[model samples]
Target: MTPISQLSPRLLWQFFDTLCSIPHPSGHEAALRQWIADWAVERGLDVMQDAVGNLIIRKAASAGMEKRKGVILQAHMDMVPQANADTDHNFTTDPIQPYIDGDWVRARGTTLGADNGIGLSACMAVLADDKVQHGPLEVLLTIDEESGMTGAFGLAPGLLQGDILLNTDSEQDGDVYMGCAGGVDANITLPYEAEPVPAGHQALRLTITGLRGGHSGINIHQGRASANKLLAELLMDISQHAELRLSELDGGTLRNAIAREASALLTLPADAMDTLSALLERRQQQYRCEFAGIDDFIRLELAPATMPARVMSTSLQQRLSDALLACPHGVMEMSRSMDGVVQSSTNLGVIGTRPEHIHVQCLIRSLNDEGRNRVAEMTAAVFRLAGARCNFDGAYPGWQPDPDSAVMQLLLDTHKELFDVLPEVKVIHAGLECGLFKAVYPGWDMVSFGPTIQGAHSPDERVHIEAVSRFWQLLVRVLKQIPER
Candidate 1:
């Protein structure tokens, strides 16, 4: 029960603790935005809300530093809301309960919001302190970054007057991110007509749990299982041996997250129950062997359940199963230039049964336009051919790298001076808001860096204690040395 404010770099942690007290999950940042706006006004700083609810807070330069280049500190205000299935937590109304583990800060039964929360906190600390020397400073806090790039897309040009933008959203304290992948969301809906359950049918619930589902982009190359895709495969296989009808299905909640759990209600002939159960057991063993070291805790089970009055039509059931199996999941291509980097990937993020039809969500990520388009096209084709309507939504461009950037050199030199070791420059597979910024502000010289965070977009998310201290130190140095315009 250690107080988060007592952690090293008290100012940043103090701000983070306050953020945790406010529920700011994706698409619900109004409360947090109001709190920040009022706080800035109290300090006599200039703040304004954009058309899309993005906050732009401005503070004048420190004494004798007005001649330096203007810098914009950027981060998202929303966090992915994820909690353990058994935990009784409500993200919309409940404050995140964070506690200290050995060397990290974790939340009880939910995500810690460390992906962009920690970065945004550093901005708060700087804005409140007049002692930190910097040029004319601006903080751009965007909304709905976890679910969609709503704020980034709606950002109008001629708003931010900064020469450079310092993005604090990337994980890994030392690795400097100059570029990131673009992505498109594939929203598929398949129509279904439920038929009354056959007289000879019996119902059972099949569940798959215990997979270490991390961020769909950051952890795509690790070969961890996707619960939605896995459950689809299991249902399809078991159906071949018996007359199986799907009653209900759901797995994974967010389209941008790797699915960690899935479940389905199925109806089959009572006599064929033992055979289907046996087949499920066999497939579970095969899955364990495939994802052996990566997802060692994978579990597949079936239990007796009350019989439902109706089930999906056999045609719709088969088509849904066929589409899910054919849908692309995991790394599709590797970067030729960067060793061990994913060039293109797609995650079968979520699948669920709604009132009228079944819907599927898949997120495609790629460094190049061609790669991203190719995967999006492929994902759409799979669902379309299976008698479902598909859409390509939230399509954002990739952030191309600037190897010769002056801002990058300033950061690298600052790091070399402080830590004695140069930080590695990288282009991550994850979707960052920097790419969207290019559409409005093309002249921005941006470099993204932050404290080490692991298991983002999952309930196991945590931020490193020591890395936050170094992250703050590096940021403070970079702010002071932004080049003269």
Candidate 2:
């Protein structure tokens, strides 16, 4: 896979390359959706779009497999748009530039979109390649999966005729997932009043960066440092040692991703402004030691910045600082049944200082409704106690595990036959559309698996090359070995 264009599974790479050349970030997948719809029609397959822009394509079963169970190939069409701070790229207009890096395919200073793009490409390949044996097939491509799960939530009942759904949006290759976490978004707001900066005060820009921020749900238990949480803690500490007044505060981009960097603009007494250098230096050293092998390059620094006209009132600044510091930002609980698996967690993903009120965003993930709600309640209480209003939205149900699943057993046996090693079955912590699909297709049996992907929802995102070959091989065989109805 030195050059992704020349990779094995020729048809899959062909469609993936086309996807790379199209800009299809969350909520902006019209161009890609239309192109895919036309491609399906040109191939003489039945294609249609649902009310919320989900693209569905149906292909007849092979001659001998017509009596087998109908299988649905599912993947989200939209991708999380995240780029490096200095990278000059636009998710809405610019094509993703992917190149082979050793055994992986990575994008240039941006997320590679392999989270579901590769999965979607596989669906197209299965439709075009007649040799890939399958039963009655239906491909479901959902939109806005990254920012929100609008597409999955809006998917209507009785639209699909499939009895078994094979979700291809999972990241790791060696793991077959049967259940996944559900999630809710915590939107927070705190009203504040602006006041004139005190006399003889200077502004400084404090930055926390160089942390490896991974996907909030998948990597929540990895002990990675959150830049937003770090910044909030530092601000609270500085207030105790000096007269700190906040002018602007902001960090992170998407709620589904852990914060990689955060910055604060504040005014301190000019005479005491020199105090931040040593403080930042001390904190940086401590943080590095604390996160030693994890966030290897975590950093904290302060620089002189232009003076601001006004700052948040003393009371508001204190409240915001306290609230941010008190908010939850890591794994809250671990699964007792599964060793080392995260059961519930939260990411303090974003913060912004608007004109009138400060906005804060969080994402909570859990394997059950009670688990997620319990964490959400704890988080909401922290913000509410600090005089902020919080509301939970985008609540989706978790996928339940089925021990007696015939489709799952068939997939497992097929994988073992192909690789001589059984894939690890898991109930993952990440939120996938299969959970929401349960609401619409209550009787459909679902299982999710995909090629190995690393650092998803972040600029360091990349997909394994050899693993893709194995993933494709397994999919091809599984389709051929589908159990008869």
Candidate 3:
């Protein structure tokens, strides 16, 4: 038995343990999908796979419950792959090692994969538990939800017969998400010339790490520092005083995650090394003070390195640095309709420099299409000024809230009856698969809720133990209370 199996809510945790044993990172979910299919087949449940790798498992209504409305339980199968810089774990081959930390479950120096894993486990438990009373059920397990909404985007119309969708992709416990933000990815490439390294210059690698990088859309309001932007600012400032030539620069991983670490290799005048070190120290202190409470663990280091054969041209380096420094990040606008809800935001998610060109990726999100487009255009304009080509792709629509949604009311009433408090109903700033499903099934009443997950999309991700139990009780009760069709 696994450590997770010993946790409370044995069925859900047992399924979660099994899931953690199979490597299911974004864009690589073949094995996990097969496992889920086999699990359903062994139990004699009807299963179907769509063209995009989405799995739909069906279970007949319980005795005396055939007249109740059918419910579709939805969760994404893939998880964002993130690990500490020094961790040697590989997302493709290594199984996530989830361990209990007090009242939470976390992975060592890597993401715990609990954002949707716990939710997926809950659905699996429902399917396997014969005692759980419910009407006809369809479990929709999607793929590639972390990196792209490929599964949701390709869902065919009329594939599901349920009138209500219960999305289990939400992170918070005491909230029922009625809607979510839409998002688009902006890819920018800047062509640059390489020049021979000048004589009498020393090479140094400047590294910025330990920042609390998090989900771009969900945590954008927390004021966490972006390593890419900070490195650009530092490079621009250093170039003003010293003759610096950039050789290589890279940071970040996923386009939807805020950059946590960045490093730049450059050659600078040998005589100015001391002054450059002093400047970096001062700037680090300044940033620490500015981001005191939110990302106080920020660190900047400088180390001597061997010289490179070629470096970026002075003009191109300056242009790239300036454009990155000018790029917009964090929350840009707040919604007037929903109090304290972020309306529009952008994350300077990644930066990479190669011999021929430099690449910069940004993720823009908004509650409305207009806000999303506005930010994408603004980001493009900034890079275009620096002779970079910018293009937006992988765009998805937002889920519009239905005030009269039957599913939402049912979930709310179930929560109040189970926990003695009403679960907050609000729109999320982050993208959820429910939006894409709505495009395929426009009339399906939808609501999203799940166990409490913190530090998602980062190495620090974890799930609350007690919250899972409460979440399970609420889900089971909601299933038992569905109105007759």
Candidate 4:
């Protein structure tokens, strides 16, 4: 494995390597915050912390650049903690182990945190480097961005003095983002009755794994299968041909991640084992063919397990399965206004059967407020029909595009001059902190861009090495070209 210190743009990689060693998962950014504050204080820079743990580090302008517009470099400090089912790692205590894999840098068996970590590292590099020419700079590092926008939501008004904000949380390189989708979370729950297992029935655990689950918003259009939806379909199909009772059900990890694995404990007639095996094989083949290009390693496993004492009643089982099948899990509509842009989508992100009730959660995203509301209502209606109560929360607004802004032009011209090619300027479907920032700081101009990262929010997450260098160059040049206030 190649050491990250040897990677080009040494300072950026060095900071990122150190960041990976700290446990900074969403809602647990205290250690990282202290480290960042200490690093800034060691250099005699001004560091301020808000009530909600958002950090603001100030750097003075270099010689002859005091009159340039103040720019805010923004990124989140928390990361989504995810790992493979077999990897024995804990996000709260264990450090992320990253190594070079060809052209990318990936963690051993967990998320690499490069989504915003790389962005934050760029800001650190700029603050540490005296050779880079720039105006007065404020680096805004927020908390709990991956799980919720708590830090951004609680940011006080008038906390920042910058006129323009440059967000570095985007995933793709060479693409400047002017706008992003807004999102809301929908939670549904249904109560059930438990019954004793029937005579002559055997217990089995059905496991689904090997799917390449990814970020729900970014990969929703790629036709990757959702384990919750797929398992529901299988259970529904099996219930038609066999006397099966569901005892336990669980899948997925977060409200914003597509489920890669699911499991169900079931009691079925002993004679039906052969039939169930054949059905699973057939469905597995069908799914493999459907998701060929993106998810080729899909697998279904069945093993004998200790018999559960009780199982869901017939009426409740049927209703829960029906609700799961009816729930939407992919792109609902595309933007007619912007070519090739996703307008509305939903991810049935998590499902679990608890002692008192069965819970289902989803994340809906859209470019416009009306579209976001429409999808949330539609998803709620699906569960409501099955006698489940639904609630929507954690709603965040979308960032509107500004094509004529001076900062946008500066970034465009800088990229063209540096690379001799025009960069793509467009809006993305993923949620970004800029939307939340815009709500409080209405007059501030904003744009987002970052190095290329793949499989974020998943164990396969990796960052492209060369793209980080290119992104650093672009950022430094853009800092030098900030317009006079």
Q: Indicate the worst ten consecutive residues by lDDT in candidate 4.
A: 1-10
Q: For model 1, how does the per-residue alpha-carbon lDDT over 1-485 read when each residue is reduced to its tens digit? A: 23999997988899999999999999899999999999999999999999999999999999889989999999999999999888888888999999999999999989999989999999999998777889999999999998999999999999989999999999998899999999999999998779999888889999999888899999999888999989988888788788889999999999888999999999889899789878877888898899999888788989999998789998888888898999999999999998988999999998888889998999999998999999999988889899999988899999999988889999999999999999999999999999999878999998899999999999989999999999999999999888678
lDDT of 4 by residue, 97-202 (tens): 9999999999998999998999999999999999989999999999999888999999999999999999999988889999999999999999968999999999
Q: Which sections of candidate 4 miss by over 4 Å? A: none
Clash count, predicted structure 4: 0
Models 1 onward score TM values of 0.98, 0.98, 0.99, 0.99
Q: How far is candidate 2 from the true structure (C-alpha RMSD, Å)?
A: 1.3
C-alpha lDDT of all candidate models, in order: 0.92, 0.91, 0.92, 0.93
Over 4 Å off, model 1: none
Cα displacement (Å) at residue 214, model 1: 1.3
The true-versus-predicted C-alpha distance at residue 240 of model 1, in Å, is 2.1
Q: How do these models rank on lDDT, best leading?
A: 4, 3, 1, 2
lDDT of 2 by residue, 1-485 (tens): 22567887778887898899999999999999999999889989999999999999999999989999999999999999989877999999999999989989999999999989999999889999999999999999999998889999999999999999999999898899999999999999998689999998888998898988989999888999999999988998899899989999999999999999999999999777667778888899999999999988987878899998789999888888888888988999998887877889999999998888899999999999999999899999999988999999999988988999888898899999999889999998999999999988999999999999999999999999888888899998999988788
The digit string of per-residue lDDT tens for model 3 on 59-89 reads 9999999999989999999999999999999
Question: Which stretches of candidate 3 lie above 4 Å from their native place?
Answer: none
